[model samples]
Target: MLQRLKLLEHINPGAAHRNVADSIPPPQLHKMSLPYNKVLVLGATSGIGLAYAEKIVEDGKKAIVVGRRKENLDAFVEKHGKDKAEAITFDITQVGTIPNFVEDITKRHPDLDCVLLNSGIQRGFDFAQPETVDLDVLDLELTTNYIAHVHLTQAFLPHLQKQSKQTALVYTSSGLALVPSVKRLNYCASKAALHHFLLCLREQMKDGPGNVKVIEIFPPAVQTELHDEKHQPDIKNGRQMGMPLDEFTAESWAKLVQGDDQIAVGMADRLFALFENTRQQQFQKMVEMMKGH
Candidate 1:
């Protein structure tokens, strides 16, 4: 017993004095509300992001769409009308400017109750042929998908917390977060990182003073440009693959409105069940055991 304590102390410095329980509560499943009014969705130019932006507007919420493509943003604004939707052109990959970007957005839209980090890219990399892989692509994919979101979360959390009403930080992760896709290895890994990050974020904020809800949408391959051959060489006719865009959008919106913190759509629903039933159980059990130490 003494040796085990010494080992544990060595593994985790100051384990005896530090209380993990105080830092994070034990896992509990609870229905979460999506009562956000003004929502800022990053990467809302096309695909799932754009779909969700449209839904937000349709649901009588103000949608602030941000994307790199000015034309697409303009079109979205024109279609939705200025009263319902607004657009901003910004590339999330420019990580250094995120703090200033957040400051400007919050200043302009003080009532912004939700910020959705949904920018992502899918690419194929063959590690077996190391020379064939493009390190630049890998860096860009990881930066846009994971690192940028981390920075955005850090920048936006304070703003969201200051809001008198409930606020939410939404992430569009992938079903691949749970089940690895061989073709899009880095994409899977990025979403997996995001999935774990959301888990920790939710647990920490569950009982905290902040009325912030961490919501994640796990999407299966919908008919989106993500798998286009132009982007992912290994994938062709990818736009025709998976669920229909409208169908996915409608189903996902229903789930979001139903107050599910972890919204999983289509095939992603099966993976989510597996995660909740197996992995989540084990994770909660581990947390329970840690309370004893």
Candidate 2:
């Protein structure tokens, strides 16, 4: 009788374990694939954009870097070798000229599969000191940072859609959009607008038939010369504040290749999670605080 009871208990437990295992589904396998061979890096003359370009070329892929500065573009191409990298000079702020610019580039490299919109400007402003914020500077900032990016996306959309394989459109926004910096009202607003724009585009793409992937990168302060030529005394040096350029770039590159839709490096990643949890309330409060209400 004792032996029978022990055998019964063991049999029941084994049956239960088998049932549980059967109920749980097996892990699905993802089909790994390479999407594209050629890429375009807009505003590749400096900062994160430049780093991304270097990374792509180092991976033994073709990179076409677009920027306004001929010297900077030339220097990058020379460093990377002409066989792997190409440079094109075009000012994104010139909206009327972008159609032609897009046509020329697409004609030259019909196989282009990725476009990274990284051109932007940051200006420090004092709402209390309105004299520091000139209308010309404000216009320049808006045109370069926001308006031109929209035009470039519009111009590139049709070409990207025509490709049979998956294409990627990447935008470099800022962490300031999540937590506003009082000194850079224009820059923050522009990035906030971009964040919304890309979100909407992602939604629209879902409803459409195109396989184009939209990605947004929010980079925390890195060592770059974005504010140096502009001569902003109050602007904190990014190098002194946090992560070095190479470290930030390495992490960012890894995220991009791993198919992360929204990439944030270092402190920015933590901040992004916080922003996601408290977005609506935090954004509203930021607006009110910036307005001095």
Best by lDDT: 1
Residue 205 CA displacement from its true place in model 2, Å? 0.9
The CA lDDT of each predicted structure is 0.89, 0.82
The TM-score measured for candidate 1 stands at 0.86
lDDT of 2 at 86: 95
TM-score for each candidate, following the candidate numbering = 0.86, 0.81
Off by over 4 Å in 2: 1-34, 236-239, 277-293
The digit string of per-residue lDDT tens for model 2 on 1-293 reads: 76765676787755533555687889997733335578899999988889988888877788899998999999998998889999999999889999999999999998899999999888887879777678888888888888999999999998888888889899998877677788888888998888878876875676456678999998887777766534566755643555677988888887888898888776668886776547746755765576543
What's the lDDT of the predicted structure labeled candidate 2? 0.82
Sliding window of 10 residues with minimal summed lDDT for model 2 = 12-21
- Top-TM-score candidate index: 1
Q: What is the lDDT of residue 102 in candidate 2?
A: 95
